[model samples]
Target: MEPKNNLRSLDRQINVFLPAISLICILCIFISCNKQDRTTVIYGKVTDQNHQAVDSILVVAGGLWDFNIEVVKQIYTDENGNYELVIDVPKKYIKLNV
Candidate 1:
């Protein structure tokens, strides 16, 4: 009789935790699905008109919105004349300058 009673108690304990565990798993799934990574990576090697790699060049991206210069991003070229810009794109068009 004692063994049977203990088994029942253990089963009830497991049942109490099962719903909470399942809820936690469902919440995790929703959180991971709702997150979005909204960014763009622009990369290239800068070169002069003579076709030589131009190092230390300054790259700038600008935008106009509502008659104002809304945002500007700047990055410098690497030693190998490589430049990369990770930017958040809010609109369809971007103007880049070197």
Candidate 2:
């Protein structure tokens, strides 16, 4: 019958479209759940007790979150004892080690 054929066509279309729409919705949820990362810039000069530039020194920058320290950047001082570090972390308590 014509009505039975119409029902079969509708069912076929639903079976094909439902899964595609569900996949798109699931992807949107996952994309919205992602968080963007933030960054901080640190610039300083390293010097010894005698006020002399300390070059080639290792400098580490870390962020303290939830009682955990996560290292974000590690760099060495330049010949002029100047160091620049870009850290990707949240704005919070941070620790520096030289």
Candidate 3:
């Protein structure tokens, strides 16, 4: 009787621990699947045909992903004609519109 009870107790413990372990594993996999794998940094000079700085021109970066399309960010060039945009790396392709 004592050995049978012990087996039952051990089974209960395993049942409880097994679900917890499975839950942890599922959570880990979910997090990994949702994780962003890369990032993007863009730098360019806004210039006119005459090679002059075009200040205040709006530059936008659009990101394309499997799930959705999003505007990553928008930036404006400084007086020096330099612009920068930092965003999560797109899953497939990224389009830069100036």
Candidate 4:
């Protein structure tokens, strides 16, 4: 009867710790499963055939993922003819059209 009582006590202790252990494991999995966004910034200057700054020129950037083309950004050149395209994608998947 004493051994059985000890076993029951151990079982209760294990049950008490089980929820904490499960919560810790779930938290670890949640932390590890987060995906980080890889952002790439493309900087360029739009120019004309006469070697002049082309302001307000449309610059389009897309991401090639699998068989689909995702339009990442569409922006115009600033007053200085400079354009900056910030994309939340890897460099390998980026395509620019100016």
Candidate 5:
């Protein structure tokens, strides 16, 4: 019957399109997951209230969540009051902490 033929055609069409749609969705997820963030380091100089270098100061870097700042790295300032904190940021946390 015509109705049976139409049903089979519809089923075939769905079977073909479903895989394509699924592939597209998987590709999108992979593309989004491949976010780039590696060369991101927090660096700054510690200065005192009197505009003087604060050597040996503890510099702390953190990844801020909704209501918490998880400590990522910490370093001490050098003789020049300069510090560098290395960290790896993920995509779930917006690639890096603000």
Candidate 6:
């Protein structure tokens, strides 16, 4: 009788622990897969052919990735005509619309 009772207790413990362990493993995998991608900074100055800093110019980063024209990020040139944008995109072919 004692042996039978011990077997049942062990089975119950395993049932509870197994489900918890499986849940933790699944959560870890989900978190790792959805991690944020690395970003690249695009900083430059906007100017006309006359070679002057064009202040207040709107800088746009747009392109079609996976068949869709999208604007990843935008920034306005400062007094020095300098703009910076940190965006996460593939390094294939992105359009720089200034």
Give the whole-model CA lDDT for all candidates, comma-separated: 0.77, 0.82, 0.81, 0.82, 0.77, 0.81
Give the TM-score of each candidate. 0.49, 0.52, 0.52, 0.54, 0.61, 0.51
Deviating ranges (above 4 Å) for candidate 2 = 1-37, 90-98
lDDT per residue for candidate 1 within 1-98, as digits (tens), equals: 99999999999999999999999999999999867564767789998898888889988766655555544578989878899888875654344332
Name the regions of candidate 6 deviating beyond 4 angstroms.
32-41, 47-52, 63-65, 86-98
Query: How should the candidates be ordered by TM-score, best one leading?
Result: 5, 4, 2, 3, 6, 1
Candidate 3 residue runs with Cα over 4 Å from true position: 32-40, 47-54, 65-72, 87-98
TM-score: model 6 vs. ground truth: 0.51
TM-score of 3: 0.52
Model 6, residue 2: what's the lDDT?
Answer: 100
How many pairs of residues collide in each model? 0, 0, 0, 0, 0, 0
Tell me the tens digit of each residue's lDDT in model 2 across 1-98.
99999999999999999999999999998878755466668899999999999999999887676688877778999998999987666656554433
Residue 11 miss distance in model 4 (angstroms):
25
Write down the worst ten-residue block by lDDT for model 4. 89-98
lDDT per residue as tens, model 4, 1-98: 99999999999999999999999999999878765567778899988899899999988887776667878788999988999887777655645443
Show model 5 residue runs off by greater than 4 Å.
Answer: 1-29, 91-98
